[model samples]
Target: MTAQTTDPAAAARPRLRWLPRYDAPRLLAAQMSLIDQSFGIAMVGCSLAAIILAAGLMLSGDRPGALPWACAMVVACAIAYFGRLRLPGRLTEAGAARYAHGMTATLALIGALWGLVAWLYLDVRMPAVVICILSLIAGMSAAALAVFSACLPVAIAFFLPAIVPVWVVFLATGDVEYLPMFLGTPLYLCVLLVFARNYARVARQSIALRFENVELISQLREQTARAEAAQHAAEDASRAKSVFLASASHDLRQPLHAMGLFLVSLGRTGLDERQRQLLAHIEASSGAAREMLNSLLDFSKLEAGVVTPRARPFRLQPLLRKLENEFAPQAEARGLVYRTRDTTVTLHGDPTLVELVLRNLIANAIRYTQRGGVLVACRQRGARAAIEVWDTGIGIPAAQHRDIFREFHQLGNPERDQRKGLGLGLAIVDGLAHTMQTRVTLVSRPGRGSVFRFHMPQAWDAPEDTPRPLAAHSLDGLRVLVIDDDEAIRGAMSELLSAWRCECRTAESEEEALAALAAFTPGLVLADYRLRGHRTGQQALDAIRQQLGRHVPAIIITGDTAADRLRTAHATGTALLHKPVVPQELQAAIDTLLREAATQGKGAPDRQAAVAK
Candidate 1:
């Protein structure tokens, strides 16, 4: 023989040659592990077997051989049990085969001792002794098969020896009366071995499955940890993006806001044809910038969830008419027909919110449609009315129907043309629809046209009557107080206010503004939302009220679009305006706030609080 390998697995593997090698080393290691744990219980069983054998002999009056045999069996059990106790707790790859072989031999030796006693302790003439030895051997072998079945080779080694010697001793007697007992012993051995084979197969499969489950659980935990880490990183990135948008929006809007104020103010001055011509071009550019900024503001407001709808019963007919009037001229200029169907339907929702949603839809329809017309119509559907916007300019593809509603995702404008817009129109529409508890559904075809529709709950009951405002008063002698941290914005606002012939006072900080409240009582207050010294316009408004001892109509102009800031400004119940406010919008906000103030009697009513003396 050439040099043999020292690997114990190679040497011990042949013991399992009768069975297929299914991961032989690991399977052997698993068997050895089971044997190591359950060996003590198996030894306890051997001790009981020893007691029964000794007791059977004494009862048969054959005490001579009985004591000696019992002593030998007990000694065998002790050596097998004690030898395994000193081994390592877990089997090593190198030691698994070695330990498996050792356990097998030790168990086989105990079985051999039991078989030897059967031959020595048998007394054929004494039926009690003969019956006791055969019964004891059968029970011992069966017990061995149960405990060592995890290692099939060890179970077979222990089972065969513990049983076959009894049959051999009885057959040698050649007594025809015991013929059946000796002959049937071989058949019984065959049956028990079959059961041991089945148990070992089942146990092997169970052990393999248990290992697989442990491995799977480990992998699942690793994947879950990675997913959680990825989620946290995504959240951090989103927060960072929001912060960047907020600061960039504020920085860019400051100068743009001043430009609008100055442009409108300069337009009022008498200019030559050339000067006015240059101004108109500059004004056009400013208007486009204002549009984009407004889009951003609207998206931020909606994302912040601050645009709560003040729901009420409003006539849908008037809203439809207003949209038609506004978009008709724009669509006609584009050589597209803009039509609005007449309906006497009333809707139970905030009129402002409904108008906003319709306005964006109609604007998108008109903007996208170049040749064909745009149609705005309403259909009654049971308790709801479906308002539809149909356009025939450039139809959207079916694939893009969902994507078109995502913010900053535009179709047919890959170059991101500013005139085509910032791609926030549909997104804002979707958001507004969500607030109204409705979904906007789209049906479209490429190269054809698209129809966008959403249902509004129908107001079956007629709307309760509400007061309408009187014609807006002129800004002349309005006693306005303007507070802004930006110098250019404050100057531009004052010039614009002066042109409108209003008595306007400007303060750069909340402190300066609050001090100014001493000599003058302001009919209106205009403050910037973000200010120096960590103050806000709302704070200034509150201080102004505390100072004058009366409610004052205030407007908070802001360039910041942070969600928290937007919510805070909106919750103040003051008129909040975005920066880069042109003179037209600025005047409109002022007029609306002042008008509402007059209607509600909110202006500084009486500092005197006159007492009837």
Candidate 2:
């Protein structure tokens, strides 16, 4: 079998959070180089003194015995000079052999010093003063390198055996005239001083560079950690969306899919008027299911940060009116009271996102309560205003308070709730609250209701205007143009409006709407956002207005919750009522528009008629 090997690049890759440790050989080499340079200068000083002695001996008269000894001293001086060439760079700080070679060369020079001294004492008249001065400078220089090299203390220990003899000779001699025999001793001392200073500078610079490298490495590691954390957060969010879609997919699709079948079934059956009304209720239930799914999809987008806020100065009371009308009928159906206490403060924030948050909270409160009530209230607090939703319901558990805010998490009780939702309501509230830099709080206990509250900044620069309560005009006898491509939806809406005593004219296209407009003008227009044959609600509404010679009040009712729908609706200043439209909400929207028309008297029509259309 052939041997297998790992890829070198793969092997070299850093482990997860690997920490670096000290290496012994590298430390030893650095220390040795510093010491060797110092000792090299020391040896040069001693060699110069030996050459001077040899010259002095040659000048002495009738001194035959001193000649061979003088020759031996000269040879020792030559050996010391050549040894510098053989030695490697800074002994203590170099690699293994380079450090060892420096130590060996230095030891040889020390021995040569001894040999020169021995030969001079035997047969030559050695200048004790000169030799002593030169040797002292050499010895001092060697001592400094030795001390500095103690950082790598092993190198300093190796030099000790060679240093002792030099000290002994200087102590033994006391001749005063011998000092003049060596003139270059001070110059040698200066050379050693220069080398010692240079060694210290090199060591300091190396350590500084190493520290900078480590600092840069630390910053890189920190940035990498931050990037990893962001990636993990994104993955967690994606998984949450997947799980939510998986769990609620069947429930959401079942009602919509069944309603289509039921409508087909109804057409085949020969139903009486009462039976037809019951079939209409089935259709209404299907529409409610579709609305809930659209709401879930909207919340998912907000939680993913795909939607941003479009905030401006607006009175808080109008938003409160919208919520009150939307939920009042549902509350009444359960025999629970719904109330609103509006504040007149001008606020700044994305009204659509804010309204969605409040709507979810209010709806949830109504779902949980058995026989109590829900309240929407607002109050001014310093630079901000607090929007609150209070309810008397099955209160949230203290332990599960936080978990309820997570996506697709519902309280695990067997008692079935009629108002089943995708359970992302609170999660969306949390996300939007974060983006707006607002805080949401919960106050509750078991068997007691919960109060959900958030704060909004006051628009201080808003035009001074007193806030007013919404008009109490019902949708009775108000004329409305209902334009839609779907005949069934159009008929259902017409029946619902007729029950509210509104004059409803149904149209399938712009041509149909224009034909209707020729005979009568409507007070308000409610249109399906998507019509047949590439036509849209706005085009139909516009054509009707042009024929009637007056701008018509309008709002868009749609099953589509795509970003384009939201953008176009807001851009045209039209109210968007997502389908299947809540009857009370639709009636309230028509009432608000008719009242506005009565107040403005149709002068230029605010160009906002394009909103719901």
Quick one: best TM-score, which candidate? 1
Off by over 4 Å in 2: 1-23, 26-154, 170-270, 273-281, 300-329, 332-354, 369-372, 382-384, 394-419, 431-438, 444-448, 457-613
In order, candidate lDDTs are: 0.81, 0.64
lDDT, model 2: 0.64
lDDT of 2 by residue, 399-490 (tens): 98899888767774445353667676788788878878887899988798899999999888774464586766777787878887777666
Deviation of model 2 at 237, angstroms: 6.1
How much does candidate 1 score in TM-score?
Answer: 0.87
The TM-scores of all predictions, comma-separated, are: 0.87, 0.52
Best candidate, lDDT: 1
Q: Say what the RMSD of model 1 is.
A: 5.3
Q: What is the lDDT of residue 327 in candidate 1?
A: 84
